[model samples]
Target: MLVQETLEFDTPGRGSTDITRRVTEVVRAAGMTTGLCNVFLQHTSASLMLCENADPDVRRDLEAFMQRLVPDGDPLFVHTTEGPDDMPAHVRSILTGNSLNVPISDGRLALGTWQGIYLWEHRTSRQARRVTLTIHGE
Candidate 1:
């Protein structure tokens, strides 16, 4: 069986926002004992990842690094219809990813102790983003 759900989020920059708990909630609600959970961001300027959740600094550092790598404005992009962050956001999402696959066992996500699922928003302002979660298993 496959179960799917959509979630919304607000972000401030091209960075990661932890969504581990929400994913877990969906997994539990799905009542799947064994399967694969696939999470996808339905946008061009956002992505997903599994990263360290134990430390806030980790996320901060990642955000900082991404900001430095992409910055806010660039002279080469032609798709600047959304502002300076428009192209950079897309680039950041491309650099990161758009989806994630995680293991599920005994109706729970098999994540590491310090690991967490994140929604990497690659926009400069707070925007409503949608995340689609799909579970395939018994």
Candidate 2:
């Protein structure tokens, strides 16, 4: 069996939004006993991640690391049409990636105890993002 769905999320600027529950809901709705789920983000300024859900500090630290690694308004980039965060957002997205593949077991996401899905908004301004999920299995 195969199932596909698109989900939209509104991000409040640069931060991580927990989306594990939403994805799990989709998996459950699909009724796939075992398979693979592919989560694909449809934006260059944002990316998806599976990170530690037990602590917010881990996310904050990750953001800090990204900010330092790819600081906004850095002259190294010239694609500043959307302001300082524009080009950096794309870079961040590339570094983090835009999709995830998780195994489905017993009609649920096979994530670790501390693992959670996140939509990481790289831009500095609020924006709407879309994520498309594709699941296939028996």
Candidate 3:
């Protein structure tokens, strides 16, 4: 069986958005007992990940690290039409990636105890984003 849905959410800007519950809801709605749940972001400036959800600091620290690693306003970036954050956003997205695939077991996502789904917005301004999920299995 294959089930799919597009999830849209507003980002506060340059941080991680906890999307575990939403993705889990999608998976549950799919009614797949054992299979793969794939989440694909539809934007180049934002991405996804499975990270530690137990601590807020972990999210902040990771975002800080990404900012330092891919600082904005580089002279070499030709894609300046969207401002300094544009190119850096793409870089951050490249680092973190734009999709995730998780296993489903017993009608639930097989995520670790401390792990959860995160939508990392790399842009410095608030923007809307969408992630499409597709579940395939029995």
Candidate 4:
């Protein structure tokens, strides 16, 4: 059987925001055991990842690195209809990721002790984003 759910969030920039608890909730509700859980982000400017959840500095530094790597505004990009941040956002997403797969056991996500799921928003504004979660198992 497979179960699915959608999660929404408002983001500020290209950084990680923990969503592990939400995924766990969906996994428990699905009642799936020993299966695969896939989490996908619906937008191109955003992505998903599993990262260290215990440290806020990690996220901050990651955001800083991305900003430096993809700094806003480039005359080379023609798809800047939304502004300089638009093209940079797409690049950031490509560099990061868009989905994640995790193991499930006893109706719970089997994440590492310090790991957590995150939605890596690459946009500059606090726009609403959607994430799709799918759980497949017996």
Candidate 5:
């Protein structure tokens, strides 16, 4: 069986939103005993990632690292029509990713302990993002 759904989320700019529970809910609702779940972000400036959820510092540190690695308004970027952070946002998303695939077992996500799914917003302004979940299994 295959199930698919699109979910929308409002991001508060330049941060990560924990979406593990939301994804799990969809997986449970799909009623698939075993399968694979594909979480895909429908934007170029945002990303999907599996990160440590136990400590907020982990995310904070990661954000800091990314900012350092890809600072906004970098003189090297040529795509600045959307502003200084625009190109950088796309760069950040590219460096990270826009999708994730997780195994589903017993009608639940098979994520490891402390591993949580996140919608990482790279833009500096609030934005609405769409994510598509595709489940294939029994």
Candidate 6:
């Protein structure tokens, strides 16, 4: 069996949103006993990852590191039509990624105790994002 759905939400700007619960809810709603759960972010300026949800500091540090590694208004960037942070956002996405694939077992996500899914928004302004979840299993 296969189930798919699209989630739309507004991001509060540069930060990570813990979306583990929502994703799990979707998986549960699908009622799949076991399969592959694939999540795809429909944006270039935002990315996804599975990280330590137990510590907010981890999220903060990662954001800080990305800002330092890809500062906005860099003279080397040529894609300036969107804004100063535009190109930097894309760079950050490249550094991270745009999708995640997790295994489903016993009707639940097979994530570690401390691990959680996150939507890392790289843009400086509030933006709407879309995520597609595709589940394939029994």
Better of 3 and 4 by lDDT: 3
lDDT-wise, the better of 4 and 6 is 6
RMSD of each: 1.3, 0.5, 0.8, 1.3, 0.5, 0.6
Candidate 4's C-alpha runs over 4 A off are: none
TM-score of 3: 0.97
lDDT of 5 by residue, 1-138 (tens): 999999999999999999998899999999999999999999999999999999999999999999999999999999999999999999999999999999999889999999999999999999999999999999
TM-score-best of 2 and 4: 2
lDDT of model 6, residue 96: 99
* TM-score per candidate: 0.93, 0.99, 0.97, 0.93, 0.99, 0.98
Per-model clash counts, in order, read 0, 0, 0, 0, 0, 0
User: Which of the two, 2 or 6, has more lDDT?
Assistant: 2
Candidate 2 C-alpha lDDT tens digits along 1-138? 999999999999999999998999999999999999999999999999999999999999999999999999999999999899999999999999999999998878999999999999999899999999999989
Worst 10 residues of 1 by lDDT: 9-18
Q: Report the C-alpha lDDT of model 1 over 15-110, residue by residue, as the tens digit.
A: 678888888999999999999999999999888889998888998898899888988777878889999999988998899899999999989999
Off by over 4 Å in 5: none
Q: Spell out the clash pairs found in candidate 6.
A: none
What lDDT score belongs to each candidate, Candidate 1 first?
0.89, 0.96, 0.93, 0.86, 0.96, 0.94
Q: Write the per-residue lDDT of candidate 3 for residues 37-137, one digit (tens) a residue.
A: 99999999999989998999999999878878888998878998899999999988988899999999999999999999999999999999999999998
Give the residue spans of candidate 2 off by over 4 A. Answer: none
Candidate 4 weakest ten by summed lDDT: 9-18
lDDT of 6 by residue, 3-62 (tens): 999998789999999888899999999999999999999999999999998889999999
Q: List the residue pairs that clash in candidate 2.
A: none
